[model samples]
Target: MIKAIGGYFGLEMSRAESLRYPDAQYFQSARACFYALLIQGKPSKVWLPYYNCDAMLGPLQRMGIDYGFYAIDEDFTISRALRLAPTEWLVYVNYFGLCDRQQAEVLRRFNPAQVVLDHAQAYYSPPVDCLATLYSPRKFFGVPDGGILVSNVRVGSTAADEEASHQRMSHLLKRFATSAEAGYADFQAAEKSLEAFDVSEMSQLSRNLLACADTPTVIEQRNHNFLTLHARLAEHNALAFDPSTLNGPLCYPFLNERNDAVRPDLLGESVYVARYWAECQGRCSPASWEYKLSRLLLPLPCDHRYTDADVQRVITLIEKGLKGD
Candidate 1:
């Protein structure tokens, strides 16, 4: 499974057992964190990466927030920007589980209190302190709904009892009936309606699934599988993996010289590789598009659901696909 999904050095839970509410769930969804930040901070100007999910821009625009795009290096790290504006808010993404410690430090140096770390991808490895840290739980676990907005800034009172109950019920219903097709449909409907969907509504069943998350074991296995696949595929000159400082990785993203040509073969191997942020609104600047188009990112299943044998099978399929056999 790890080989199939390709998240060799990705995020995992810190604990196996679950909690009652916020404690149990780390981050909810990238979209949720995006919304929450807009609601809570209400900053005038924000800075984000050009190579991020397009879904994020909608909320920012809806909130009438102006944003600037920063340039990312070949390694997908944001090392340069046009200029440091009076940007009251700055959003930093922990891209693909690769934490850019230098960028974080730079942001702090400029304006310590203005940075918001979107740990949606690099939740497992976080800085000791920051103004705010956001997470998307579904990215790591089997939960249907949940997100955390950790901040030094406090908000007003909690949701009313009836409102909370109604939201919870709606979440449960959505969870019970959700399928890939249904989810796609829902997204289409939302796109038509111009209404943003909140991802914090997990069903009881989904919550139960969260209880089974085992962080340490998952991390160990994922790293092992990642190393194995990396070593095995290293001989293939046509395929190259992203070299990053990953304590844990969320996907094994690689650059393929023949990605457009070999895509069909990869799919036939049952390798459900993704273009990741291709459809993300205007987030894909020219540089972002060049990198994404030139690369094939594979998210290996690091969860407890997959075994070493599954990893080997995935690696074999990838090797065969690369060989054009």
Candidate 2:
């Protein structure tokens, strides 16, 4: 039989919690938020980082907005800085919640109104003073479907399909009932549904679910989990990031040239890690650091649900992997 460990970490609320107010406006997905903002801003074009998912291209292409790409250093730092004209916007990702507010303050070099910050990985990081800040709660929580957009620009309001969350919840349910492996099909189905995207408000189901969230627990537990895992991996880890930079992290990103071996080693120990992106495999050369890093960088599990034993188990597995056990 398949096994399971953690449950949903989204907002960390229990079943007994009452559904109250959902404090912010939400959308169908981060991509939908991008579409809505594009409609309102009508920018001459957008400047997106070369290190990005092609999903953003969907909305920009649909809107017929002129766009171009820029590059980032291995440290994920902006390789080249540009001050776009008033009619254009620059999109920046806070990466793994490691880019703190002070780091994001660099955008002030451009007009705040021209920046679009993607907090898809930085859910708890507050919105910087930018034209728009897009969030993917599913990236940080157990929610079946939802994305939040905080923007200075105006977009048309649209009521979202309430049933969408139900269609996507099978995997989440199966994970709770049995093991995450049992929910693989539903998870794949949920992922496939994103391409049929639209601009809609967050569903009441999601809003009610979000209302039950315990904000403080979500922040504290995740921060603690990240640090605990980092402490074990820091001396040998490839990320040049400072541990103090973590706020509410998505995962413990571990860099290993042998990620191919590392992944199966952990999986054999019932600890499954994730590959951040598959889109980069063909676009960049295999010999390049970006390509190899993209291919081998393993995002380790350190979400809130894991225990001290769980963390120790991961450390043990990694050590075993390093030793080629």
Candidate 3:
């Protein structure tokens, strides 16, 4: 049976000459990537950061893998002083993609083979010699439902590509065509749809879109936008890091005493900023450093989508919001 030659056309997409991690395994979601690793290693216990989103606990709970919470210091370092058993792993997040130094310290202190580097926010940060490194590319790019896992652990290949990628595209397309306000409903729907926690291969649609990305340009733009924000607000920001170590950070995390008040003010002015993790408040005590970080850290937009002028506008609005103007 021969197929018709060029009968109809489909979506046209460009193929990139190279990808950041060409040999990395692709999964439907970051949690699925972690699940793949957990299933392979069968770790006896795992430790997660208390200052993280509850979504991360999904794979572990589903697999019946025992897990405990660990505390993060004001500087995002692991505060726990416990040694891991032979079959236990510790998950450390590259918080706001601004903790390379802390990540290096963790690698130095802990056994590299028992560490899980959650680079969900640190897409541009390369993987170190660890048990596994997981990345949720959707956080940084326009693609829908794709995750990258780099590790020595062989979670053999799969052909069962996720089928819901097209359905989840509504929000990305809507937001691109119109404004964020217009697409808010669809965005919420898209997010809710991914709660199923399906562990499958990355969908072909998402993989193609990711391959089409101009990664070099995006990285350059994101770094520039981040520095643009940091240059003006470094003195006021409580979270300190060397600007030289930054590599396409997720956002410029600005911590201030007035963050709780200014967040709503910025929203009122149509400048939406995201809180790191509101769920941490329910888990960690109010006086804990992690809880304080959850309450005051404003992850201001510094991705590749905006220009320097746009960032300056956000800075001006932040200043006004702080002043309660």
Winner on TM-score between 1 and 2 is: 2
TM-score of 3: 0.94
Tell me each candidate's RMSD, in Å, in order: 8.8, 6.3, 2.0
lDDT head-to-head 1 vs 2, winner: 2
lDDT of 1 at 261: 52
Q: Please identify model 2 stretches exceeding 4 Å from their true place.
A: 1-24, 81-83, 101-105, 285-289
Q: lDDT tens digits, residues 1-325, model 1?
A: 4556664664343446754234322333456556656777788888777666666677788788888777666655566544455547777777666656655655655565777777666646655356677766556654445455666665332322333323333333453577434354543442332234453433444455666666676666666666766777666534344545545566655556645655676567655566666654344545454346434555444433557787788777767767777
Give the TM-scores of the predictions, in the order they appear.
Answer: 0.73, 0.88, 0.94
| TM-score for candidate 2, residues paired by index | 0.88
lDDT per residue, candidate 2, 1-325, as tens digits? 6776798655354553443223345788888889988887789989887556777889999999999876666777666566678788888877778776533654756787888888888887887667888888778666777888887576875888878877788898899989989998999899789777778876767667766667777778778888887888887688866766667787888887666888887887778776766676556667655576677888887777888888888888887787778
lDDT of 3 at 226: 89
* Model 2 score (lDDT): 0.77
Worst 10 residues of 2 by lDDT: 15-24
Indicate which candidate wins on lDDT: 3
CA shift at 236, candidate 1, in angstroms?
4.4
Candidates arranged by TM-score, highest first:
3, 2, 1
Instruction: Note the residue pairs that clash in candidate 3.
Output: none
lDDT of 3 at 285: 94
